[model samples]
Target: MNARLPERQASRALLIGSSRFSHEGLHDLPATVNNVQALADALTDPAMGGLDPSGCRVLTDPATPKQVGDAIDAVVNEALDTLVLYYAGHGVLSRHGELFLAVEITDPDPYRVHYSGVPMTWLRSALAESPADNRILILDCCFSGHAVEAMSGTASAVGGKLDIRGTYTLASAPAHETAVAPVGARFTAFTGELVKTLREGIPGCGPLLTLGDIYPALTRALVASALPRPQRLNTDLGDHVAMTRNPAYRPPSRSASKPRVVSQPHRSPTGPHRRASDEQDPKVAAEFHSAMLDVYRKAKKEAGYNAAYFLQMVQEVGGLEAARRLIRAGSVSSGFTALWEKGRLDLSVEAVVLQDRFAGLFTDEELDIARDRLAEYGYSSAQTS
Candidate 1:
């Protein structure tokens, strides 16, 4: 039966979301927590699909780090078939690649922080200790990096093979950007789409939707629609991950009715996306530039990266085609940056050209249009940025 296959053991989901918190109160944490509760309910409903709630334990929202840590500690030892941790609140990341998913966090403070958010290192250790051989983490907060960032580089196959455990982290954005919450959406854009893709039974959903796939989907969609795009950070040492293209996966149908959770809202997770296509429409491409410029502005206002850096990008880089592909890759894809870091070190005209304002920062390749345009300025290489 589809209800029970491959694995019939217990499973657990730890979820958290925070929003609209007062200087001392939480804002929108309830919405994401509520959605997770619904997801938990659906997972428990034998009539709809799979296992019973008895097979799983859930930790929704804990006001303190110790509370969260303690709750997760209990779940880790439960020996479930699949262990999932979903956090849907505001997240903050440090320059050192650390991440935090807030619970009762009222204000942003790194040390002596309010409302403890479980650290990625700690969470990963918990996963390492979890009795489950398969562990999946669906992080809906911004800058939810750490565990995933640890797993980013190409690795060699040592010993007989590299098979330890299955760990998947779906972070909303890079550790450096703000996560977007759509105007009327119950939760943030990343959480909404994730629920849709996972529930839609879309072919590209689930374990197939790797960090690479999800990172781009959120960022690109955010950039296209004028919402803030989250940076995608990931980690997987041995096994391959399928990003939104897994054949065995299926999304859940649109809820015929809204389901209530313990003490929160009854909003649906899946909804419509609002980005224009760069590949298909030239007009969209032009608009995207303006939209990205806005993104550049917000990045400066919110994060404080040098304005000239982004301004140089918008003014110097000419075409957006590469950006489309770049954001789609999900990772930082800092293509224009690659020239300085990897290809050109001397800051040659090529290096400077790579950093051109109009040049695509999202990708490395130069589209035909970009190439011809650059040629008009004396550079002939149409190669990706």
Candidate 2:
């Protein structure tokens, strides 16, 4: 059976990576930081996972179990279609042979782990309780394979015997083996391959990538690199859920023998004006332009400007009307802050509406209002211009 990508708005992902450790026995994994960031980028890429940036959350160096649990619970509550929980850090075994995910203050003592670490059983229970149709748990730490055992009802860990349905658990290594994190590497061994697969994609896979398609490729790559083989446990076709669009997929070309027909340009009317390529509604044009700007900024690794919500105001009212609303609102919007954070001062509303291509979209008074808004935020028109 064919599988498709999850509904972007209905799916949520929480990525947790503990990169530092205060314990003497546990070594710090600096690569885990890069692992979370790179994975977040891959998942939020429109050409790949197509998830909204707001839907994916990254937590680094969590201080306690409650912090991680709270974040997971939030995502579980928000996600209706798919929930992805990813963790990268140290995995230590307790006295009862149970797995415990190491946090910033985690100690090596088995008895102390109850207070310092997050038990694998906690994750299992969370997944079992989640209302999402598909639950994906990715663990990149030593003894992570124990999670598979716990979910399968074979592990003797406390609270590990829960029946988790519609879940897929992917572990970096065997229950006894240590996951690799080569020194000076950008990402952990297992996650590096995962990110590569999400970015470059499998050559022959169809248009969408599923867990079933990714597992064998991961196995082959890890074996070639002489790394510990990954393990997985899937229940109720969970493996068939599509994770992302295949980057390497190419649609078949049209037949060369088909005859070509040329047609006159179609003109759309806007009030008393008619244009061949312009949108009939100025508000719609503004929204489209704003969304396209976000796509461009994202490709360049800049922070998103929250174009969807911001542009909705323009779509509901015309550009000039939206400008009046913004002036009356008397506060800078999040989109402007996002632009400021990315050092994209040039994309501000004052600069955008002032561009030659958008000259007539807003009146001089509206342009002055935009400039005044920027000035209120301590930016000059000359700087934005």
Query: Largest TM-score belongs to which candidate?
Result: 2
Give the Cα lDDT of each candidate: 0.47, 0.75
In angstroms, the error of model 1 at 241 is: 8.1
lDDT of 2 at 122: 80
In model 1, state the lDDT of residue 304: 44
**Can you tell me which runs of candidate 2 are displaced by over 4 Å?**
158-161, 252-385
Give the per-residue lDDT of model 1 (tens digit) for 169-244: 5566654556666656665677666555434433322434344334444554455777654533322321123322
In candidate 1, stretches whose alpha carbon ends up further than 4 angstroms from where it belongs are 1-6, 19-28, 45-51, 94-97, 105-107, 150-165, 203-385
TM-score of each: 0.50, 0.65
Candidate 2 on 1-385: residue-level lDDT in tens?
3477878999899999999999898999999999999999988988686578899999999988888889888898898888899999999888888899999888868777888899888888888888889999999999889988988888866553566788989999999999999999999999999999988987645677788667766876896899998988777667668788888875534642132222333422211121223335666566646644544356245554445554566667755455445443323443454465456756655556544455345444445556665664456776632
Worst 10 residues of 2 by lDDT: 267-276
User: Evaluated with lDDT, which candidate comes out highest?
Assistant: 2
